[model samples]
Target: MKELTKQQSKVLACVEVYLNKTGFPPTRAEICKELGFKSPNAAEMHLRALEKKGYISIQSGSSRGISIVKSQQAFEKNVNQMPVIGLVAAGSPTLAEENIEKRIPCDPSMFSDSFDYFLKVKGLSMIDAGIHEDDLVAIKKTIDVKNGDLVVVRLEDEVTLKYFKKNNHNLELIPANKDFSTIEVDLREQEAFIEGKSVGLIRTH
Candidate 1:
């Protein structure tokens, strides 16, 4: 977990305890009351910091909307940096000038595999795999792929994230969520290519 400041640690502790006891995260007002803060804004600051540091996720438009994603530290800034790709335009390469949002400094050792770039996920097709829209999926560019690997692939004009499996000339792009169906492609007809494989993911700050 990211090292929290003394006050942030206290607020996080309070939230953990409250969530454990009540099955829900405490509201900003409740957090302030518990920590004896002068106002909710003070608590909000700490909460936002926690979220940014990848310790929690805050759902908008609701009170007590904090969800503990995990007690893990995010990538620390280092010499290595990578581009973050936004919504990919159809028929364009993944690394096209129009696709990249910006680059951020990151520690190369954060994930087991070194990543070339970060792609901003576009939908909930991989939600069951814990990858949601707007999340940055670490991508390692390569055409050499294996079955059952979470991958970012290009299907003609579209780039999508899915589990990959290839057999003969047929390829299956599987979705983790039940709401979506698996995409099957034939190498002989439809255009498809492996852009990269997902090495890891981090929420958008």
Candidate 2:
């Protein structure tokens, strides 16, 4: 099984504790109250990371959607092919047919974590972080990821890659290069969704 980072472990523990106490998984709001997070989004970020690591499985369309995997074998990656997404359009899903540049046979074990698809890097906002133009980044689709992780995010249908940092009700999309400025989003007013976390990068150039 892939080792979880310190924060990831804490989130897992939080989920376990809530399950033991309430006889069901905790809602994101409950996690915020327990974990001292300023917003539900913070709790969600950690939950998504836990789910991606295979320690838990999240049932969509539920407020308290977390469930334990309970088996090491559940962590095994079995992806067959990975879709390469390019230029995601507004109001379109990330993996929409028109956005898919190509499909490549990708070995599951090639990356540290299981990925949903590859997003072709288009710009230099994260150049200092070693991600360059035309790089194919392994993206694990999730809304919640640890702060400072490289994240693919969508704001009002515009997709971009940046370091994610959340504080209270405001989240910052930080650029790695000096040429670019960090984008600040107010969760109260602006809706920014985290599309995925970058687990690996494939550079052909």
TM-score of 2: 0.59
Give candidate 1's error at residue 30 in angstroms. Answer: 59
Residue pairs in steric clash, candidate 1? none
Taken over the whole model, the C-alpha lDDT of each candidate is 0.80, 0.79
Q: What is the lDDT of residue 161 in candidate 1?
A: 90
What would you estimate as the lDDT of candidate 2? Answer: 0.79
Q: Cα-based RMSD of the predictions, in order?
A: 14.1, 16.9
For every model shown, what is its TM-score relative to the native structure? 0.58, 0.59
* Residue 10 lDDT, candidate 1, scale 0-100: 83
Q: Which portions of model 1 miss their true places by more than 4 Å?
A: 1-79
Model 2, position 34, has a per-residue lDDT of: 84
- Tens digits of per-residue lDDT for model 1, 15-104: 887877788889998999998998989999999998987667899888888976543212232235566887464754466444657656
Best by lDDT: 1
